[model samples]
Structure formats: structure tokens, C-alpha cells
Target: MSRRDAEDLEAAPDLIAEGARVLSGADIEGARFEAKIILAHILATKPSRVVINADPLAPDSISRFRELVSKRASRVPLQYVIGTHDFMGLMLACRPGVFVPRPETEVLVETVLGSLRPGRDRPTVADVGCGSGAIAVAIAHHLPGAAVHAVDISADAVRLTAENARRLGLAQSVRVYEGHLLDPLLAAGVADELDAIVANLPYIPSGEIDGLAPEISKHEPREALDGGPDGLMYFRKLVSQIEALPPRRRLVALEVGLGQARQVARLLQSGLECSAIEMRRDHGGIERIVLGFIDSQSH
Candidate 1:
């Protein structure tokens, strides 16, 4: 390591207090919470357990802890540094190229789940742009009979999604595919057979991407963030594809960017013969989810 890294490791604190102080000095918000988490990770213990036992750090462990702290202080995403993230109560493995699941996307999952029929067993669902398989895994986990087909354009995302599905014990129920949007599903002859579809596609305007926080603009993949010039390019493509599906009652749920919900809804209405269209707000009160149902008679 560098000279400064070695010195920091040598002088690393043993207790949580010192770690928190060091993180605070680095201007990391929620210093105490983050310190406890980092220490717990280095010690291979739970965060709750760390609170009950305040023990001195071993020299090796201290060095590892300091290194993790340094990475966090440098604005590496906490999830990427820790190697996992929580989504819908399930721990999902995260990596550099794959997109991280956000808390706001949970609402989209709920909307899709709520659209399920009461007596349907083994309903087929597709998660377009299934980054890291968060939505696919969560849906399969919650709805035991759901057969989830997850698609992503990025090979890295496809691999991560499969890994997460296997790790979560939903490998048998969630199928992973690599292709743009719903193309894989269509190619597999399941396009017209789907019961529901969900997507958390890229929706950030290309020009505005540079203005995003370093954690997002720098750390997250641009293909997963840039939604083209107006941020509606992918949405337009997705709506067109969904509209082409054969006449059937299928639920379609999507997560959109701020102020894009209305435009998305209009696009959906114009492109698809929707029996109903509903908008749901995220915790931040921003209209986030756009849901629509295509009735069988619309064919």
C-alpha cells in the first residue's frame, strides 16, 4: 500500500468511537452508522453484534477496516465496496458494471405483484432491463408460483442477475437472458404468453448525467443511467414493443424519472390499448411507477 495507507493502518483505532471519528473527519455523512457497518464487515460480524461487543482490533483486521473506510471516504459506493445491497428484504450481490437497485424501485415490484390474479399459478413475468436481478429475484421469492424471465442488454448484468437468482435460491424460477429490453423474451417465443412485465430502465437524460452525484455518475454504469437525449428513448422503444404483443390481458409496470411519469403515461396510452393506467408515487412523493393493463378485447 501507499505510505499514507500504511501509517493510517498502523494508527487505526480499536473501538467504534475512533472509527466513527475518523469517518466523520473524512466528511462521510452518517459516520457512526457507516463505521459500525464497515467494522462489522472487517470483523465478519453483524452490525448489531458490533454494538454489544466493543473489542480491540487485530492489526490485520485494523488494516482492512482502514482500507474500506478510505474507499468509502473517496466516494466509492458503499454497496459496491461492501459487495452487496438489500432490495425488497433480500441481499443481492452487486458489482461495478451492474446497476444497483434503489429503494424507490420497490414500489414498482409491489405494483406488479398487486396486479396478479388470485387463482393464477405459475404466472409468467418478464423483468426487462433486469440489472442485478433484484426485481426478478424479489418477485420470484414473494410469489412462489411466478416464473420470472429477466432480460438485460449488458452481459455483465445478465451474469449478475443469474448469480443473484441462484444465491437467493430462486434460480429455478427466474430465467436470465441477455438482449436489449424484451427482445430475448420475444425471441424465446414467450412474448405473447406473458402475464406481466416490469422494468426499471435507464431514464436519466444524457446531458444531465454529468450533473449526477459522483457515486452515480462515476461508479454506476452509464448504459444503466443514460436514457438518451430526452431520457425517454428507451421508454419509447419499450412502449412500442409492449404495444405489439398479441391481444391478452397483461399487466405492465415501469419505473420512470421525476416529471417523466406524465409523458410516459401519455406514451403508454397512445401506443397500447390500455384498459386502465395508474401512477404511483415513491417515498419522496415523486410520481415514479406507471402501470397499465392491456385487456384481451383490445386485440
Candidate 2:
């Protein structure tokens, strides 16, 4: 066969067809896209370019492509191999064991940004359990005057978050620390000074961690997934800490497990009066974010 014929056989459509043969499951469509993305990255091109060129994959490229596809077939996340994910228009670094920043959490960042106005600025903000520094860096990048601090329990997570902040040129604006939810911030003397606290803490019930997608259950850290028996452990602790805060600090934004929105709202209302509650929906319309603000006078 001529080289042109080989190229025709290795075109985008042909590659996708080959991918379909290897991936058979409820998520086959996602698998196909993943395969294309990996192939495009390996070829140093865009997804659109892959469809246009359709050049035959070199023998070396084919072997590497198949290796990635096999992992995708087993539900391994593509972002880990690519080492980056797009969140709120930011290219965030991701790796094995570090929680991949999800699109749903972008709503939380939007809500936090919306709360801050041009002239009225909060002096400090704390991002609890800030995986990859998505929330903290976004906040610092957007609100130049506000002081941003992030804390995570896992040392690796803290390191990854710090790396991301530096990559995004937010290392000077945002501070990343290693400690439990509020420990690091409190130790640094910024706890009570925080005007807003945002957290995307682990909210998956311990029993259900095994049931999550392999991309998450197997690759991501368990400490970032398990949220205790009912998946409210982190929320409970967060609310407790909020109540402990001084009167000057009040607003808090949290990302909860799907279907746990109401329960999380109730937990917040138990201690602080909710002046406003906005539920930010994911692409599927599920409530993915829960924002609450305490009345200034009450606190």
C-alpha cells in the first residue's frame, strides 16, 4: 500500500473508529474524545488539526497512543497524563493523587468574585482545602487588593497548590500552607481577619469512595474524597470554625456533594443566619455550589 493510503487509513475518523473498538462501556463517547485529545497532544497539535490532517500515526506514536487509550478504557483521567485542566479559563496543573479541579467548582469561584466589588474590598480570604490552588489563585488574580491564603491537610496537595500558584504568577499574592482546614490560617494569625472563607473540601461518604469513578477513586487522594459516614464531616468542621471566628468575619462559600445542598445549607443556618443563599448548578443542572453570607449586625 502507498504511504498516502496509509495516511488515509490513519485519519481522525479512522482513529476514532479504532478507539470505539477498544472502549466499550457507558462512557464510550467520553473515551473517544479522550483518545483524540491524547493523540493530539502527542502530535503537538490541536484536536481540530487532528481531524484535518489525519496523517498516519508513526509506529512510535501508535504505541504511545494505544497505551494511553488502554488507561482511558479503565477510566483513568486524561488530565493527569496531560498534567493540566482548564478551569475558569485557567490552565491548572494536575497530577496523580492531586484532586483534578472540576468545572462545578468554578461556580464557587464566580460567586466569591461576585461578592467583592471595586471599592469595597475584604482584607483577607481563606481557601480551605484548596486543591491545586484553583480557588485561592483565582481569587487573588481577580481581586488584587485582597490578601488570599490557602490551606490543605495533605502536604502533597499543599505543594501542588503552591506550584500552581507560582505557575499562574500568584505566588506573591496568595499563600499556600500545609495543615488541616483552618489550622494553618489560624496559626498564621489570619483566621479572624478573613472576610470570606471558601472550601471545596472532601464530601464523599467513606463507604461510597469505592463506588466513585475509577479516575477519581483510584488516582485521586482518599483524604480529598472521604467526607466521613454521611459525607458532612468537613462541612460540620467548617461550620464549627466559622462560628468560632470573630464578629468582623462572616461570609463563607462551600462546594457540597450532589444532593447534599440542602443539608449543607441547614448546617450553615444552624449557627449563622443566611442573608443570601445561591445554588450554582453544574452543566447537568445539579446544584454544585452553596454560598452563604451572615448579616453584618448578627455576627
Error of 1 at 283 (Å): 1.0
lDDT of each: 0.87, 0.80
**Clash pairs, model 1 backbone:** none
Q: Name the lDDT of candidate 1.
A: 0.87
Distance from true position, residue 186, model 1, in Å? 1.1
lDDT by residue (80-184, candidate 1, tens digit) is 888889898999999888898999999889877777856556789999999999999999998998899999999999999999999989999999999988898
The numbered model that scores best in lDDT is 1
lDDT of 2: 0.80
Clashing pairs in 2: none
Give model 2's TM-score versus the native structure: 0.88
Question: What C-alpha lDDT, on a 0 to 100 scale, does residue 231 get in candidate 1?
Answer: 97
Superposed Cα deviation of residue 203, candidate 1 (Å): 0.3
